[model samples]
Target: MPLYRSWQTSHAHIAIWEITETEDFFAASLGFGSDKKHPKRRLEHLSGRFLLQYLVPGFPFDKIQISPLGKPQLADQSLHFSISHSYPYAAVIVSRQQEVGIDIQVYQDKILRLQSKFLSAAEQLICANDMQRITLTWCAKEALFKYYGLGAVDFKEDMPMGSLQRTTPEDALIDMRLEKTRETCQLSGLIQEKFALSYI
Candidate 1:
């Protein structure tokens, strides 16, 4: 199976799929009807849909709609789900209990150059290593953005990092806050060999 990892709780579940199959495989397996000009994007979309069904058996994959903010939602709001992809992997988080978000990013050195765009000066000082810190912050903000399910969010100004603790070489726990909504939550992260995964 392509499922790289999965986490389950009483209210929510997260599944990550490693997209090693060809685009034709997904198109045929999931009945992907929409034609995406880019092969990678098409694979991501279909893989996300496939992971969604795996999480919720018999989910109406064809009835999903996009919100004004670009969030994909079920037509009847029967369930809430979020999908994210970064190159070779696609992640899906589903919940029948509450809102959810998930993000997976392949680690790259370029994130250091783009740190200021999404992280504040104060937040930048919290991490010991530039690459790992930046990747975690980016993943955290991305997950937060999905949880908010709204666009027009300023990553540096709106989402702030409260606390960052590295428990192991491949795992970290983060406390994040949204300034506009006054909401706060903890996000768990896994620093894999090739990519980093964060979800809440």
Candidate 2:
């Protein structure tokens, strides 16, 4: 089990798993009831469950359901959780205290082409022509979208990437706004050697 890194608070815990095992490995151990046809997707789903269980011992995994808005929630909303994956990696965040969101993305230059779709002109200016910065900005907004826990979000308009400051060589502190809900969150992001992870 390649557990990459984890963060924890008094009521919340987030974990990431580097997927190196075969789908069969997770299938045997997880035995998830939903069988995804795509092999890669199946692996991601199983790994997410495994990580979720790891973060919160005895979480009611069987009670999980997707809301009409496409956010995963407990049948009774007893526990707040979120999940995300980028090929070969899966992430989960669980909170007994508050709703949560987490996202992990494998670093790729291709994101630049889609920046215009999710980022405004001002947002782009703040990124300042750096792919790493651009990638982290995108991840921050994605985390915010997940944090919002509802569908039909306009990335560029609904979630705006605010000012960014480099705290270290490979970490950044980001400010983001949820325009629709008029809420703000400060998120910390990590630029791993192969991927980027963000949460709030």
Candidate 3:
């Protein structure tokens, strides 16, 4: 299957790509030099530069710099964005107005080990039997944190999956409470054998 998928939300534009390796995409698309070959560093470099290019065509090199908060910013400040990746995919969301975030995770046993770090007690009870549900919950909260532009927020202590109402594969509601601020967002996705790729 192709590695890219995208949709426009009421507040922002979202894009997701399934990459076999992050280095291949960054090196080819962003013109990274030989010295910047490490995957994590390359991704950080490319993601900021790419988003700047998206906001301003032919933006000058010296004008691109990430903020102290780690948010990408062009000297022009035309738009805002966030990016994330897991084992096989990288995702980005761009917005002209509201902040946005996107994340993708491949289902793995390691998620079980990390559950307490990301899930609340009530969330665990709600998703105990359904592995896909648990993964989706984790991804949603991570995306939400990224959307908030706060890195390293504890998913269990800082964010909780609130009431959820499932309507259909393409139309479901996910409510969340983060740091006394409440947000209700819609989640849409198709389920593969063991993974669910969610979008909002």
Candidate 4:
């Protein structure tokens, strides 16, 4: 049970798992199939479901449906939830009372190359070319996008990353915006040894 971390927000249950199980283990226990082309992706899909059930006991898996916006949701929106995975890490946020979003990303240098695609010039300056900062910023916006649960959002323009404040070495908060709905809020983030996690 490599349940890396699990916590609760005011309205949601959140968890991040360091995938240490064999693919067969999850595949058999989950009994869920995946069409992901990569082996790691298949493992991630199964493990994500595992965490969803872990966080929300008796979660209605059968009611899951893809919205026109491409969000995986329930027909009645009974429980708003979101999921994200980064290789050996899988994260999920589930709340019966409100919508939720969560994202996890491993520290990777590739974020530098793609920063221009998702970060405004000002956001780039905020990141200051630091790898972890850049990765966390990207991760924050991703969480915002999932929170929106709508299609066709511009990462750099529609969802922007704002100032970051770290209260402790392992905990942080990011000021973020969702332009489509003109939303401004603080997104919670976690700084870990190998990955960054964010949610809203």
Candidate 2 lDDT over 63-170, as tens digits, reads 889888888899887789989999988988888778787788887888888888887999999987677788888888888888887778888988887798888877
**CA lDDT, candidate 3, residue 68:** 71
Tens-digit lDDT track of model 1 for 1-200 = 67898889677898989999887777676766447788788888888888887888887977889998889998887898989999899998899888888888998888888888888888888865467767877898899899888788899999999988889998899898887799988888878878887878
Give the per-residue lDDT digits (tens) of candidate 4, residues 1-200. 89988988788889888898988888777666777898999889989999988877777788899888778998998888999999899999998898778889999888889899989999999989987888888889888888888868999988877788887998889998888999897898898888998898
* Candidate order, TM-score descending: 4, 1, 2, 3
Model 3 agreement with the true structure over 36-93: per-residue lDDT tens digits: 6766656545654454355445646566577777765555756666666563555666
Alpha-carbon TM-score of each model against the true structure: 0.94, 0.93, 0.73, 0.95
Off by over 4 Å in 2: none
Q: Model 4 residue 96 lDDT?
A: 85
Stretches > 4 Å off in candidate 4 = none
Off by over 4 Å in 3: 1-3, 20-28, 33-64, 180-200
Q: Distance (Å) between predicted and true CA of 168, model 1?
A: 3.3
lDDT of 4: 0.87
- Candidate 1 lDDT (Cα, 0 to 1): 0.85
Backbone collisions counted per model: 0, 0, 0, 0
> What C-alpha lDDT do the candidate models reach, one value each?
0.85, 0.83, 0.62, 0.87
Which is better, 3 or 4, measured by lDDT? Answer: 4
